[model samples]
Target: MTELLDIFRALADPTRLRIIALLREMELAIGELAAVLDQSQPRVSRHVRILVDAGIVERRREGSWVFLRITRDGAVGDTIARAGEWPYAPREALVIAHDARRLAAVRTERAAVAERYFAEHAPQWDAIRSRHVAESEVEAAMLAMMHNRRLGHLLDIGTGTGRMAEIFAPTARRVTALDRSPEMLRIARAKLSGQGLPVDLIQGDFLDLPMAGASIDSVVIHQALHFAQEPDRVIAEASRVLRGGGHLLVVDFAPHEDEDLRALAAHARLGFSDAQIRGWFASAGLLLENTETLEGGTLAVKLWLGRRRSDEDQPPVTQEGQGQRKRLAA
Candidate 1:
């Protein structure tokens, strides 16, 4: 079939193959891919066009930048995905090793740039983030908590760097990442451009989300509430967009005496307590479904799960796996 032949043709080029390999590591923007390949933007774009036309790669647009990644859903994407798994010939292995080294250098530069960005930003991110357990641990727990629920369109409120969007992409049919800062959104656009997930980045106010009422299936507020002047108002605005039966996941610091965070970090509030957040959800017509806390060296992080009422006439949705509350705060 012509379709099959197109795929073979796309893979025939060495540059295209290398691009596929690089994408397996993480999503990359067109500029990032060009840098990694040491090729011109126009030249790389042509190769990308070939793979994209063959349904082997996907492109996502965020602001002025475009990001690329190998497709992950279709048959051709599966075939391309197995390229790294297949044993390579001795000569081919050498080429791959060389590419791997180039990738390492590229990653080093990215890490350095990220470090500089964090250092320049206010709110001593390292100091605050250090208080909690590793991010990977918190993310894993979030996934576990969401395992039993039906996954749908997910809205990530204050998607600082698009990490939650990346993590929830596989389960969510679509993801809308909203942030107020254009600079942060720009960085997030580059970081989350690829992998074929339908992503939308918006620079807007959390107090009034630019969306229709009852349109979203799930809303996530990841470590962004303490920055808000009115955290409860933000929750109410989030609930306004929830489709009946949608869930809300809130992650933030539990109440703390970190006065330094208020001045040095630009924190509007020190932290939030369970009683306070739960009451906010109740006021917004959401019922508390689950609550878990993961204590860190200095500050304790909390995860609150709530569900919007489906209908007053309809029976309440019974959430399974609602075991004893996880109380790890110390």
Candidate 2:
């Protein structure tokens, strides 16, 4: 009763209520929230702390940035949604309209920044992705490859844009989408948020996962390893997390002499050869199940499917146990 009352009390504040309304648009940093609320970060953070304590919001740290988003898919979220529908007084309506304008401005700024980034990088992305067989075909291959197999606690490393997670979320028991960039995670959160599947958007490195050892049932590294400073270490870490009998899927370009990629896209390793990746898999205690290559203009994408050799494995949790970001505060 006390905890429930605490939640109601937290929302009783007009500022806090407004904060929830803004979060429904997208996750924001304290500074961003300050801008949207037209308040100092300190004051905004005080309200943020109260909401977090009341389970009305979630806070996560990505390097130096702290992001706040609504608490989704739960009783608290349902109650908040109902509250959001309350009839607004004249003052409340005026304040909300003003807040909405400020929020739109913030989103515009964010989109502009993202646009600049994509403008500089889109050519590089399209160049590499273009050569690859169409994305739909690759996705179909991935789906067929995992046909009829269990996808439990699936982890998508370097889940840029969270597309792979979205594709596999329907079948997987739970999906943990991990990435290093705060900006990318923000985009991913918007796409994955409010979905039926249990998806966790975590901002972290692919080489050093935040999950416990042997915690995931399946791992997907799609078009991400080529950027790794140390791809071997990445696979090794993936090995560390996979429970025995769990599956591993690596989708990347085959060995290529795309020297231009290094300068344009920051690709550390050009591409991986079958022998090189297979060696890494052997060292990681994963047995290669099959390798399929799809042809493209000048590149070939290889999919390596492997299974942990050890018979004993640990189950993480049911899909529902994964998370309820869908109900995050609206």
Candidate 3:
């Protein structure tokens, strides 16, 4: 009863209601909310705090910017989620319509900034792409591999420019795009907004993911593992978060003699080999299910599909199982 009253109190204000409406459309920063509301930043933050304390809003920080969205959990969140369906008074309707127009302007501003960043970084990305098979071909192959699988909770590690998250969001129950670079996440936020799916952009390291164990149903490390100083640790961390039978798809370069990439692109490793990847998978208790190789230009890209071994997939912990394990170790 107290919680219900707190929720009602949070929504009792006009500005708070407007903020909720805007968030329902897409995630917005406090500054964006202020711009839409024609209020000062401090005032908007106070309203945000009220909603957050009521469990009606959530705040996610990526770099210096904090993004706000409607919370999609619990009974209060579900009830407030239906605010979009509630009939508003004539004045409320007009105000919402006006806010929607301002929201469009905010979206335009975000797009312009994102475009500038892309233009500045396009050459480096283009150089790498020029050396690999066409991105379309790579994406097609990935789709075919994941076509029949359920992408329950998809995590895209090192989600540079959010391409993988954007590509897989439609099929995923929830998508989390994580990157170490805040600039890249900003660019990704611009790319993944309003995709009609719940996409969360997080600033995090792949070697130590900020997720609980066995929480993810699928993971995609797309063309990003070569940047890792310890790719094996990255694989191990990914496996830790995967549920039983969950999938991990790694798309990266096959072993190559590209020394220039090391200096020019900040690549920690030149490329990877089949034996190295298979060994890493086995060490992490994952089974390598299938492999696809795409060759073009000077570099070749390989996709290794691995599945986490469930208890059912493992031998029972019996005397026989111990002997089998001993033999495998030998």
Name the top TM-score candidate: 3
> How well does candidate 2 match the true structure in TM-score terms?
0.76
Residues forming the 10-long window of minimal summed lDDT in candidate 2: 321-330
Clash pairs, model 3 backbone: none
Cα lDDT for residue 176, candidate 2 = 91
Q: Please state every model's RMSD to the true fold in angstroms.
A: 10.1, 10.1, 3.0
lDDT of 2 at 70: 83
After superposing candidate 1 on the true structure, give the runs of residues whose Cα lies further than 4 Å from its correct spot: 1-115, 119-123, 312-330
Worst 10 residues of 1 by lDDT: 321-330
| Residues 17-122 of candidate 1: C-alpha lDDT, one tens digit per residue | 8888887777677888887788999999999999899998888665575767677776886797688786677887787778778776766665665556767873
How does residue 198 of candidate 1 score in lDDT?
69
Error of 2 at 246 (Å): 2.9
Number of clashes found in candidate 2: 8
Q: How many backbone clashes can be found in candidate 3?
A: 0
Between candidates 1 and 2, the one scoring higher on lDDT is 2
Candidate with best lDDT: 3
